[model samples]
Target chain A: MAEEITTTEEKTVDKDIAALLTSPPKRAPEPTPELTGKIVKPKIVQGAAAHYKPHVAKPEIQEKLGFPGTLVENWQEAAVAKMRELLGKYKSLQVYMDICVRCGSCTDKCQYFLSTRDPKNMPAGRAELFRQVYRKYFTTEGKIFGKLAGAVDFDLSLLAEWYSYFHQCSQCRRCSLYCPYGIDTAEISMAAREIMDSIGLGQKYTNEIIGKVHELGNNLGMNEAALRNAIEFVEEEIEEDTGVPVKLPINEEDAEVLLVTPSADFFATPHLESLVGYAKVFHQAGINWTLSTTAAEAGNFGMFVGSYYHMQKIASRIKQAIEELRPKRLVVGECGHAWRVAYAFWNTLIGPFDMLNQKYPRPQHICEFTLDLINRGALKIDKSANDEFVVTFHDSCNVARATRMGDKPGGQFDIPRELIKAVTNKYVDMEYDTIRERTFCCGGGGGLLTDELIDVRVKGAMPRMQALHNVMETHGVNFMALICAICKAQFTKIMPKYGIPMEVAGGVHQLVGRAIVLGAKE
Target chain B: MSGLTLLYTLFAYVAIAVFLVGFLARIWKYATTPSPLKIPLTPAPVNSVGVVYRMVQEVGFFKSLFYSNRIIWIGGYLMHIALLITIVKHLRFFFKTTPAALAWITSFEIYVGFIFFGALAFLFLMRLVIDRTYYLSLMQDYVLLIFLMLIAATGILTKYYVRTDIIKVKQFVMGLVQFRPEAIPGDPIFIIHFTLVLLLLIYFPFSKLMHSGGIFFSPTRNQVDDAREVRHVTPWAVKG
Candidate 1:
């Protein structure tokens, strides 16, 4: 009987390990509204520790390269060599090291600093982690006393800090603008992430998401079956609301446009309603378009986690999907960073895809697509449905600055604003900033979507939330609309936290679905 | 009259005249360009305390003096501080009758000037050896550095090396200042050094070196970080 008890105890221990390996540890419940209506600011350590800890298993990635021990050693050597090589070869990289005067202007400027308050979160300190390395290895002063020159010795401890802080930065180039000498820390952060991944030390969540994107063509790990189910789900909802069975056609041979969005819409609420809106527009315009299950997602998570190979692989899938579908034009759905990744890098990575036999037209945002229809007299929008709320467009950072399309006039922001203006007379500018290249990032950037970093993301978003909040509180502004999927999730999730009651939705496409007066004869 | 005095006066006069013309020309060009915003690289006074904080923060906040990696900042700061001190101490040549206070300050400045001159030379070597500064550096950067070294070297030589008659050098300079034409200096070193300084001043307005004065107009550093708080409609926008 004692022997039997020992075996049972051993079995129980095995089960616990398996559970721990398979799932993230249970988080203490976040404070709810009843407990504290005020925003719960994560204590600096509490916030960073939560978002930065590895969640998914990384052993498989290590095992793929063979046994863990050998892989780790080889990765470290290779990563160090590559960093040294990059440093020695690239004059630009060296300039970054030599140029900093350490003026603390960039400290308070970082949103991460505002949110976390960690002195290390300052851009100067983050750059120093690498700067010290450069001085130690290359500079005359650093060759003597490494720490005195601001560099710590290369070790596992330093690597861990690198992984933690490098990911903390959102790669926003805002710091670049304020720098007296135009030092771009974003580039340094990217180089560091590359080194980390080369050494098999990348964050599990980002790498796993990237792997999913490659295998399944979406970051959420949704397959073709899942994509079909989501379409059917949206279709059912649309039928109940519009009283018409709107078919979200998939894989049609010759459609005019292919609608693509971030997979978050497939799993979340009111976002799928954007799909319904697009269907209504195409249905009313009598336009032909197909959604391809093979490449339904518009996201490119490679940039988020710092993996170029994954970025190229995901971009290739998008190109292939576009080729097979053979659409006249490609329309990107309401997603900010996705559009940026596609707009800025896709053409360079996957194209002159002319080999695929579909003369791929340039990608268009949904706002631009609707504006084209309205300008050409293809779709009619009645103002009645959108008349209730005075609307203003929130320029998402990725859309506004990261992507080339939105930076130009009459590009992304203009089309949406024009459509809104044509449809409504009640439109009011937010008491703060409005449209064009000058825009704020929605808080949920850099893939901080995990349930763990919710508080931090909400707090980082405070600056933007406050701007919109002020407009609503004082100027009677009510509706906030945006084009990026991340912005939609960011505003929708965090706005309630700040007691700002303004309703949030994606740009005119959702409003178009509700407002377009389709003919009874059709 | 010293030969060095004659050459120094001629070269110095020419450098000053060209420097003024070039400086004015550059200012004209800047005024013509369309930069309207005066955004500071440092955070602004959103509140009263922020203004004082901005001042303190500008003083090397760890990164200020030592932490920054930007080669330009390190080199630029060393070069500027050194040059400023050397110019202030070299004032004995420009003034006819030095004030008692000025004479005492000049004595102190001469000692400090040697360290700054050494610093200026080090900066020149840094620009040549460091690949980033070298590659991005324009012809003007070299010209500026070379001119500075020459000026510092000549000033040092007059004080300590090949000592010259200060009264004689002063008379030539005072004649030039008093709007009288004077014979060129005899010393080849003095002529070369003064001529290089003259050329640098003449070239300054057209070169990227104007970044000293042009930092105020730099769109990258000067544009306010208030984009999220305020709208900046670009001049190129096509209206709806």
Candidate 2:
């Protein structure tokens, strides 16, 4: 009887251990009203991570950027050495790797993990992919115990995992907001991408765009003539609509302001509308603003790849433009990460703008310029002009989290909403958490907006889409206003995938354009 | 000294040395590493004073975690607070004359131990039961929690069920602090409890527990949001 009891107890303990060791398979999250927009509890789905991997950059593109043409012979050693180099270079990377207590505060905060139940998509899990390697090679415990300390050796599978999942992160920094240690996953992802690039494993979308910026002075490779023509087309269209000859000045020296905007504004719809809005604001404000052929594009792809040299190189075009044009003020148009790079990094990267007028901020956002005009009663707005559509704003991740808009701390959140409310009578915010500093990425920011990453983009957009869906159902909100060029483009492309109309996506300045009484001020 | 007492004394010295040296080295590395860019997750405080205030709120109240998930905040915050109290209570062992305030803290030791153990169990169970937490959890994560739980349980057992020579345990601890070796008390439960603590000290620097130090060094948490005003540059990135 004693022997039998002991045998049964042993069997039960083994069964419990077995159950604990084996994880359940990934399941598709059930679609519910709460999942759509109500901010429901976070649920775990198995195998939900890294469903798609983006294509790698071609050797030519890689070589142009001064990276290896192909994966090195000893890639593992190279990657590890790159990590060590980065540890010395970036305090954020080093501290983030050391700190993350995996308290699960940020687990539910990441949109990628929320959309795809893949464990690796979780911010902690994502950082762990790099931390594991850091531990094994750099730390003492990992050297002795290895797997027992959650450390793993560098291998091809791990490298492949890095490529697939790091790209999945839009580097939105939402997870960092909730992390107790403020471990920004963007810092880790940037370091990982930098390391991968060091070993010649670069993403095609970001590298290709950076190459174009290096060669053509813009992300779209538009030459000076092409850019001139695009601006002329906008000038004509605005004149026909408002009967005002709002000159879209180009390459003109002695202008009061230099307008540097994303190339998408020149070519893409909704984005172009904002470009028109900027011109109207400039024309009405009587600010002598000119577009530069050299620094035509505000969006810098160098930030996406995590290369400071390339980021500096790309940002130098704007500095060159500032030097040659000698504009009294620098006003950036609707671009997300570009604004972050300009607002947060430009001063450090290429600044001490002693030459320009100190009357204005060294680099002012276009929204800030327009909003100031409105606030000062310098510009008249017909709020009822946008009565046909109900609007809600989507805060671009970089603008919401990475940079400030005005002197106050949360001016990024208020300035855009204040602009929207100024332009339209009907405006409703998405859930409190889904907007402001706690906003979700447009699934396409951070260089993952390329055509090849469409599937990842679509899946990654689930949280934002759900938030929009809820508002659309409750308030009948027909227009989604955005400040970021990437957000506008991404929403335009992916909103249709979720059964929402593509026309719903547009720039905040698009509303500004419709409501601004152009000739009234004159 | 007997073999058992000598073995434990040697282990105590090694553990303390590893803990302090390893922790200080990690802190130094984090401190000296350069952050080339101004990448504070914004809506951040604009001044250094504000940044210090933000860090204090984050470390003291787990403010970010509170904003993130309440359940996690409760478990994590409670565990940390309980651990802090327990550490204060344990200070009586080292001091020849326990401070009046510390004597008061020792009075609540049993309650602190219960809360600590309870919070640890909840956190450990969360890793097992919650699919997301479970998937993210590693063997070391589980082991750390279980190891801590065992330490708490053994301590409670020594205090309540199996009576241990507390005076001798304090003497041994005081002797260790004073650089004089003393025989460790031959109480089985106390021995187990004390050994687990030494192991924890040895493990703390090498594991995720370095978060205590790393939190202070985290650039995102520690950096002022005045990048625009300050023109912040690092040592390596400074041009001429």
Q: For each of the candidates, what fraction of the native contacts does it recover?
A: 0.02, 0.83
Candidate 2 per-residue lDDT over residues A8-40, each given as its tens digit:
987875564333223233445333223346444
**Can you tell me which runs of candidate 2 are displaced by over 4 Å?**
A1-35, A38-51, A520-522, B108-110
Evaluated at residue A25, the lDDT of candidate 2 is: 35
Judging by TM-score against the true structure, name the best candidate. 2
Candidate 1 residues B54-154, lDDT tens each? 43443323233233334545655665666666666567777878877768867663454466566667666765664333433334345556666677777
- Weakest 10 consecutive residues of candidate 2 chain A by summed lDDT: A17-26
Provide TM-scores for the models: 0.64, 0.93
Best by DockQ: 2
Candidate 2 C-alpha lDDT tens digits along B1-240: 899989999999999999999899989988889889898878988888999899899999999988888888899999999999878788899899999988876765357778899999999988788777887887778889999999999988987789888899899999899989999999988998989999999889888899998888887878888876778788776644
Off by over 4 Å in 1: A1-57, A61-71, A74-76, A85-95, A180-182, A353-361, A406-412, A430-438, A501-508, A520-522, B1-240
Docking class of 2: medium
